[model samples]
Target: ACLSRLELSALKFISGLNSGLISGLNLGEEKIMSEKIRFSVVCVCLILSFAVMPSGAAYAKRELRGKIYMVGEKDEDIPSKNTTIRIEESDDSDVSTDTAAFRLFIKDHYKTDETVTLKVEKPGYQIWQPVAGKVRIPANLENYHEKVRLDKLGSHRFMSNQAFAMLIENAARESTKTVSKSDEKPDLSRYLKEWAVKYGFGIDDVKTEMDKWAADIEKRQDNLYELGLAAFYRKNFKEADEKFIDMANLPVDWAQTQYNLADTYFAMEDWAKAAECYKNVLKVYPNYKKAIERLKLIREKR
Candidate 1:
């Protein structure tokens, strides 16, 4: 009985050992699965960061900037004695956002070659379209003054001595000080003529050149109509009619001025008159469609 009991105990011990081994293997597999899941999550986060962040950083580093200004009658005629002009880079037309206006007015005048697009707006004046202009900054102007302009929302690409000199020269030319507040119609046509003269072209010369272009357009249209008309008179009714119809609105007195008259008669189905007219159109247009069509139709009718 003792020996049987010992055997039973030994069998139980072996069974327990086998169960523990199986449990340990299952635990190792679970740990490996968890590690793989953690690694995959880390890889996804790294890819997303590289995809979105660098482009934004590059844009921040290299964004473009510029300045703005308003033109008036006189240099001193600045719109407001106390009001500073605002400069900004914007696709918007609103000038109320003139946070950069002050930067435009430092040292009694300043200039910028970095083409400024300025939107001029005031309490009573109409909101104007943004104008493309350059600004000049002054040499004596301190960074502090520039900051004041920046406070008004004036933006800048770079500050320089040349810009300041330009501002001074510009201010001396025409300031809003000389302009009056009234409904005045400036002679824009006269101004354009004057500008043409300034650019070394006389007004009459410009007009003459324009007339030449107009004549050329007319001549081309006439040539096309004639080509079509010639085909028509040759009994090429289809081509002739197409040419005549194509020139429906072109202004040209025919070479003989009688060919189209004949064509008109033929198109109206007046066979006798169409034949005569077609003959006449051919005299002038030589290739008028109506004459050919009328001659054929008349023969058929007869």
Candidate 2:
């Protein structure tokens, strides 16, 4: 008789956890011992498989298959042409797509209880990796399936410097507001000094609200970076440049920020400055293909 999905799952789970138990069991005992005792031993083993084996263990033993989708602002599907998908530990090879969707089949690449990392990359789209780039196939089954989505990269990539500056400015403004209770107050310095003596924006209060705000921005620079990119997408180059510069000044080694700055300079027709910025990016990341191409273009223009 053909095994059902549930039976297959249960058998896979039992085999993974108690392979020794199955191997040790004696089917010959049915003839040697009483039929009742042989039946009881079989019942015990079956119970142990279900009781001790973890839920979803059967699923992990199976092959994994999935489809990729690109999503837009309204969660609408977009064409995913030229997208690349890669799986760790399976192979270093990548699969590319020419349409809005791509099918993935990973067979015999993973074992029960093992995790696999799936990475998807495409130009002009934010990369997607589930659960910090890893997913564990359940050990109980023979097959698994999933659907993945990728979001487009907008102005958020361009506006990091502007975002950080705004965050800092906002922090200072909020601090000032706390000091001056009134909405219409021009003399913020006087109020800050007075409030600092009592509530402490001063050096002594290590756990002050201002200090918390400062630390918060420092910890969440990525969020600020995204905001800056949003500004850049909005054609606010001045703000975007300011945010990118601020981010770079944070001593974060982000080649993309430098590259974006170069792109901004190029947009403004400052060929010399753009060329310098692109060269800086290549200096840090010698294999940055886009920067290499842009640098060549700038030099040709010069």
Candidate 3:
């Protein structure tokens, strides 16, 4: 009997035996040859499977990159001069205890042990750098808006604060000088009174200096409030109050200035003025929480 299995290769072998004569081939020999052919086919299939197996390179992760900025500020990628911002991962489920190093990771293909140096510049500001030779980004760097504060060097480099301070001081000084040179002395008593009341400057102290030259009452008010706001942000509440109160009569920036004035009143425990300021705040921002609460408390006490 002929081999039951379809051994096409074995049949080729038999046919290549000088002539196409399968009839004379022994059934036992044909069956053995067919088995070898089937085994060879299985081997070929296995080889193909191994050749196309998936690789680890297909699933590798890529690096990330982006610029960092301070809260409520903008700067270009060319290092912000006065800023030292750090990038950090958004997920804080895992924490670390590295105080000296910042936990910001900027994925610019920064390999471990790689040293990178770049300058951070800001307009009218100075550049700053990471403490060590390298900027170490925390492993978990996929999340969160990290805070970057001004270092000592950063402050010295970015002279915005100093510049602003000098501007105010100069204006005060120059106004006095101009008054001395002017043909007519300006009535600076109002300006001095407002400055004292707004910035908590004992009006009596500056009264003589202010009276020395007729001051530009309105211009002086602006300068005082601007300085006072800067001082307020710096936590000098006494100075802030003086500035806000002196410019109270000016029509511009009334709402915010009044609101800030109210805050100072609340801080000083002048409840009556505080209540009045709160009322004014409501007229501007009806839903201001602090003002609303303070106003309500003032009414309750009455």
Candidate 4:
């Protein structure tokens, strides 16, 4: 069976956990991780326990020690091994080229939500990711592991998340058919050609404009929510408020977004605005425990 991107990533996640590459929390195991890496994981876990995840509820941060891979038509063989990855603004390629894995000063980046700019530059290839989220340094072990998806240079957009989903759905619906060796091969070019007729340019063009897919403010609901969450985890509470408030005013019934805005406000100790937002969350989800508890705490403060 040909797995889709999500399925492939899930397999990688499980593999990482088994191999001790899942760098989420470090119980100070010296044999498993370096001292700096251990501290970084501890910081991330502490933040999760106090602020975001609340017993690892949702948000998480982890280091990036994975390979750079190609977003080719083939789902099974994704990694573009030996393709050198250089961190942004650096002039040198990594000395180790076998794994296509670049080293980062991960101890610093993993503990905070700082944006790390990256690009994939092989002489004849480029990046094409449409539904790609911004990757913070170090893959999020709690969430799906991220692959630095690179692809061959083309006017045609290869393996867009849209077309990938279509391919996966089509494969599933045809699963009962007689098996053939020829059917096992992935044909990514067909989807690329199809989407090229519709969207004009590849998702990010050649510059690796990281927010190319996210620049459209009219389709801003999910973007703003993620931005708020990122800022909140970074402890940039003021910036988090700005993003969350913008998200809250949008025409959507997102109780969690309202609850997040309330959480941000309470973090700032703005009791009135926090109370107002918690009430907004209750209007949508009346029995949400976190919101209910926060509102009561605010009332007690008053």
Candidate 5:
């Protein structure tokens, strides 16, 4: 019969203790004191062996092993190391990974449709979740694999509350610059688009807030150009056309608005109007490469 390392160590320590006790019975105070120290050492060794055995047994019984990877923008996958994995409702069952893999052990097998919430955490990345930083795991599963894509801190998109708040702050800064009398006007259209992409402005609640922001910004006459571009992005062509036309009528340089109006007409398939707008853009901003290319395409089409 084969014995485990713990059992073998326990047996050896017990044998030594028995021999030492027997020898100390006939020995003086010095030998007795030595025996007492040996016995204490053996007791500590035995206790540690027993304590470690159960944890080893529990590790052996782990039925689920998971592999995790971080997905990159180019669809490359890299191991996600140093991440904390936690199972909700399991006492002391959380583990942090030094590598990209983690193992999970349960006291009992799970029932059908049983689910547990899993939380992942890392320093510079967003917490993995369906909405934010939590995910649902089926308890009855085994040998699971997860692909985690965590947005970095201060990135265009962030899932954590702290990161999202940072994104909002950055957006607000850009917003302030839009109405400021700086030598260079900040591109409000691009700023709002980036915010929408990050915060999912397609959702109704997000759209509501974004619309309110747009309304506030539209109060400034200088912001009309960006409002028109934002409307163009939203596919509100009527509003975009109105805003662009309003910008074009303004006394300021209207070359950019003319170009945008041409693009909008092209989207609407009004080739004649588009051609006219392109001509106006070229008249004002000669050597505009895009307008030159578009005119060539329109001539070929005609």
Candidate 6:
């Protein structure tokens, strides 16, 4: 114990030095240190140590952060604020969403293999569901970041829990190489059949919804980029704007999409819209030179 406060105080007393510590001990060389003095010294040492050390809330064993954005109609990641972020059932272990960001402290002894669930709650926005928003803390990494996209209220995924369960079952079957448990065979169609009765949907309608979601999940951003470039080169400003806006809506490449859309608007001399798009681009990539240049041009035009 590197020169504990009690010992230090005793040394200070014997050496004819002054100290602020008050332990009720006899300071002279012939005087003995009684049990009461020792007890008082321990209490004083504890108090001093606690006073010098930072409070528990000032630090953490591990920190995790993530971004939250709403999937707007244009597919732009509009920074969200005043949203609630929770780590499982823990309300105080983490902080809420602000500036499209939320932070958490991994204070417990959670294994790397174990995953922590994150749930987001915001007015007019759908709550994040457990099946889709699993946060796996990466092993051997200090910083962990997660990106979550929120849908507007009444647009929550899955009409019912059974539909979500079916999706999970289908995914599990497709990805796993091992045979499923022989003891239990799940009937995925039962969920769809229920949906048919409740929503008056036929097989065709269900298949159509499945196909649409599949296409969206696998959409190629590069194709949209190429098409947007082609339209711009052909002087089809409207078509270029449409293509870029579509790409932006997909939430894949915000900087490129916003820049291209802004550029197309500049070509069409839509100064205000171009300025807006350029500003949007700058929000995420603040130092983007091209966007800065276009904004400068828009300012000059005004």
What's each prediction's TM-score?
0.23, 0.28, 0.20, 0.32, 0.30, 0.38
In candidate 3, stretches whose alpha carbon ends up further than 4 angstroms from where it belongs are: 1-54, 58-67, 71-111, 118-133, 137-154, 157-302
Write model 6 residue lDDT over 1-302, tens digit each, in one string: 67666557754554442222334535652244444455666666677677778887666466677777777777677777767777774553444446778777765677675667666766666533333455566664355566777766444353433243334334334423343675443343544455444334574566466545434423643345444534443335477568667766765386678888998999999999999898777545533446867888899998
Model 2, span 23-103: residue lDDT tens: 455777533444544465456566765776678854543345555677766767665666677676665434545644444
- List lDDT for all candidates, in order: 0.40, 0.53, 0.45, 0.51, 0.57, 0.58
Ranking by lDDT: 6, 5, 2, 4, 3, 1
Name the lDDT value of residue 159 in candidate 2.
23
lDDT, candidate 4, at 147: 57
Candidate 4, which segments miss by more than 4 Å at Cα? 1-63, 89-96, 107-111, 129-134, 138-146, 155-302
Which candidate's lDDT is highest?
6
Model 3 quality (TM-score): 0.20
Tens digits of per-residue lDDT for model 4, 82-178: 6665555433245224665654334433344454555555666654531322344323543334456665555345534233333333432343243
* TM-score quality measure for candidate 5: 0.30
Say which candidate scores most in TM-score: 6
For model 6, where is the 10-residue window of minimal lDDT? 14-23
lDDT of 2 at 3: 49
Kindly indicate the candidate among 3 and 5 with the higher TM-score. Answer: 5
lDDT per residue for candidate 3 within 61-177, as digits (tens), equals 422233333222343332223234332332211121223123333445566434343233334322222221123343544442233332223232322322233233344444446
Could you tell me how far off, in angstroms, the CA of residue 74 lies in candidate 4 after the best superposition?
3.5
Q: Sort all candidates by TM-score, best to worst.
A: 6, 4, 5, 2, 1, 3
